[model samples]
Target chain A: MAPRNKYSVILPTYNERKNLPIIVWLLNDSFTKNGFEYEIIIVDDASPDNTAEIARQLQTAFPNRIILKQRSGKLGLGTAYVHGLQFATGNFVIIMDADFSHHPKFIPDMIRVQSTKDYDIVTGTRYSGKHGGVYGWDLKRKLVSKGANIFADTVLRPGVSDLTGSFRLYKKDVLEKVITKVQSKGYVFQMELMVLAKAMGYSVAEVPISFVDRVYGESKLGSSEIAEYATGVLSLWMRV
Target chain B: MTRAQQTVSIGLLFASTQLYLALFLQLIPLPSIISEEIIPVLPLWALVSFGSYLLAKLGYGVLTFNDVPEAHAELMKEIDLAREDLRTKGVEVD
Candidate 1:
């Protein structure tokens, strides 16, 4: 068997005190179960809820496995990953939400796909195979997600099934290259990353993943974010 | 596009086809059931097909177009275990 590649998960959290512990535990469990070497870097942007404190406790429990990288204020999502990248020691970097929505169980499959195919990136999609789709979302939310994906696909034709999905694995160097090229922040960051990747001719693969609603905190999505996402999509269409 | 979305889109296309067919038959002055029963049934067919389309998007098991897979339940269990592990470590959880 080929030696396992070290996987570093850069989880960005903001006011996720209650969710921090469980997600870390699940990450630990999933990595151990798959017999893969992994590290989780918790990048908290000074959440007032003291999510950093809980992350600190998790670091103590997990010892060297969990690393906490703290920022002074709430920065954008794109920057959080970039900050976490400085601390990632693994050859592969996994970017996911601190919320429970993106399950860690699919991490092994992503790693396996990357190893076998030598793809530059592998994204977890909710629109792929039998095991894919969203749960705990109402019709409105579903429509919004589907609509955003369709609008982007019609304009950019990125060719990937799920353009807005955040759960993805990237080779360290490839991520570093593409991250620098992406200019969007907030909700559009994930979409822009994939668009840039496709435009740059990077090999991308999709793994079916089931997305669940957050079990703890309130969702950050709102009307303003949706409006911004639409504008962002249009802007990206013109530029890319 | 998802299977559920495709199902709904295709359903709408079928409804439109029926509507156009009925209109065309009416222009040709067909004396068959096409002018009476089939034309009236066109709207009813559209309504029923659209209703079924919504049901499919909602993951109604009868249609089985986009039902949430069983793997979710298992993943939820794993999450629960992770929570339990955290609680055992003396973290206060509700």
Candidate 2:
């Protein structure tokens, strides 16, 4: 077998017990088949559910590949990435959803793009190119998602078409630098990281990926998240 | 801007208005010294207003976006715990 690339996947999951197992299986299939030495780092923010226990079991199942980094309390999403980064031991880092929205299937394409172009970052775009798509969201949901991205782009001019995508792969050092510079704590944190990345003139590549909605459970996103997203985008634009 | 600077902006606006009033009243030869001193307050007022705008943005950020002090405090606590754990294992946390 060819030497596998050490790809540390940092997954931030909050109350996602139901989705955890499936995500793990998918990630395992993707990396194992592709001959990649990967580690799954699940940062659980003291979720009220059994997410931590499930993560422990997955670690037991995968042993060397799945690493459970449990936190004491429910911290925000942005801080979770910072927490997970302390333990990420990979040449490249992958950030994505455990809710099944960011499919593991697109990850190979992302890796291929990065390898071919030698880009600093390869991000999944839902609305940018010809091939990207979104599933399971209603028309209104789509509009809200689209509008939020447009709003951030207009204010900060991040230059990336999809400024709010969470599925991305970064050079480990680049991820560290960008995560340190980013200050957003909630949903808008996703958008702000890209904005900061753009401001710092990082070379980025976009790959079209169909973002599927979670098959199980309700979405963690809501109107309140949107308000926080708006507030965060505005603050980052001014602060940075 | 500092609190003092914000007040200075309003004070400047007030003084500018007061100088105009003084000049109008001086047509009948009333006290005019107060107007000269107050008129110069205009620059201070403008300066204060600009400072206030920056302050307002800072205040908004502190309220809505990032809490630097809180995050730092939490980070320090985490470090302390990690250090203690390392000490138990005869390993330095550095």
The DockQ for candidate 1, computed on C-alphas, is 0.15
Off by over 4 Å in 1: A1-3, B1-65, B69-72, B90-94
Chain A TM-score relative to the true structure, per candidate: 0.96, 0.92
All DockQ scores: 0.15, 0.02
Candidate 2 residue lDDT tens string, B50-93: 76865564444223321123333433454455345434534322
lDDT of 1 at A10: 97
| Candidate 1 residue lDDT tens string, B1-94 | 3579779999999997876775756865766677777765777898999767655544442233244646568766876787788777766444
Regions more than 4 Å wrong, model 2: A1-4, A129-131, A220-223, B1-94
Worst 10 residues of 2 chain A by lDDT: A128-137
Error of 2 at B25 (Å): 35
Candidate 1 chain A weakest ten by summed lDDT: A212-221
Tell me the interface RMSD of every candidate, in Å: 5.7, 18.2
lDDT for position A204 in model 1: 97
- Candidate 1: which pairs clash? none
